[model samples]
Target: MDSVPLFALNDCDVMTTNGSKLGTLENITLNPNTGELKFLCVNPSSEESTEFPQMENGQVVVPVDSVETTREYLIVTAP
Candidate 1:
C-alpha cells in the first residue's frame, strides 16, 4: 500500500472506493483481528474501525487490496 498523508484524508472522495458520496463515512465497519474491511449499515462505536469502507444506498464491500490508488481520496476497482 502507498503511504497516504494524513492531510489527504480530509478531502477524500469515498464514492470512488466505497461506492458512496464523499461525505457519507458514517456507515462502515472494520475487523480488528484480521484487519479485513467490509460494509456495515452503521457505526457501532469505537470498536477499532481500521479498515472500514464508506457505505451508500446499497452495501458494498471494498477490500483493502482493491484500492488501486489513494491520495486525496481512495480509488478502488468497481465490482
Candidate 2:
C-alpha cells in the first residue's frame, strides 16, 4: 500500500464480464501518497462463505493499472 487516499465509492455498481452483479466495492486499497491502487474487496451483504458458496463470489483483487478510469465509480477489468 502506497498510503494514497483510498478511492471512496458509495453504492458503486460492479459487474462481471458476463454481467453478473459482483456486489459493490467494499473499499479500495491504494498507496496513499503514490496514488496507486493495490487490491479491492467485495462488500457482500453476507460474509458467510457457506451462505453464498461460490468460488467466484468473493473478495477478488483488482490490478492497480487495470483500472481504466474512475469517475463516480471505477471500471476495472476482471482478471
Candidate 3:
C-alpha cells in the first residue's frame, strides 16, 4: 500500500462504500518506531456518531486497513 502524509488527509470527509457519509478525518494514530499509520480518528456525523462502538476521546479510531482513499473522501469499510 502506498503511504500518504497524514496532513494531506486531515479534514477530509469519510464515507462508506455504500456512499453513506460517516464523518471527517480529525487525527491519526501512528507507531512511534515504525511511523506506520495505526488508526484514523474521525469526528462522526451527528446522525451516525452514536452508532459506532469503539469511539474514544471524542473521535472514532478506525483501522487503517479499512480505509480507501479518493480525491474527495476516505471510504471506509465496516468491520
Q: How many clashing pairs per prediction, in order?
A: 0, 8, 0
Q: Judging by TM-score against the true structure, name the best candidate.
A: 3
For all predicted structures, in order, the TM-scores are 0.39, 0.50, 0.82
Per-residue CA lDDT of model 3 for 14-45, tens digit only, reads 88778888888888888999988888788887
Q: Candidate 1 lDDT, tens digit per residue, 8-77?
A: 5443455445454423233334587875554323322233332445344433445555554444455555
Lowest summed lDDT window (length 10), candidate 3: 47-56
Off by over 4 Å in 3: 47-52
- List the candidate numbers ranked by lDDT, top first: 3, 2, 1
Give the better candidate number (1 or 3) by TM-score: 3
TM-score of 3: 0.82
Per lDDT, the best of the predicted structures is 3
Judge candidate 3 at residue 78 and give its lDDT: 80
Q: Candidate 2, residues 16-61: lDDT per residue as tens digits?
A: 4444455666666768899656666656534544222233646655
Higher-TM-score candidate of 2 and 3: 3
Superposition-based RMSD of candidate 3 using all C-alpha atoms, in angstroms: 2.1
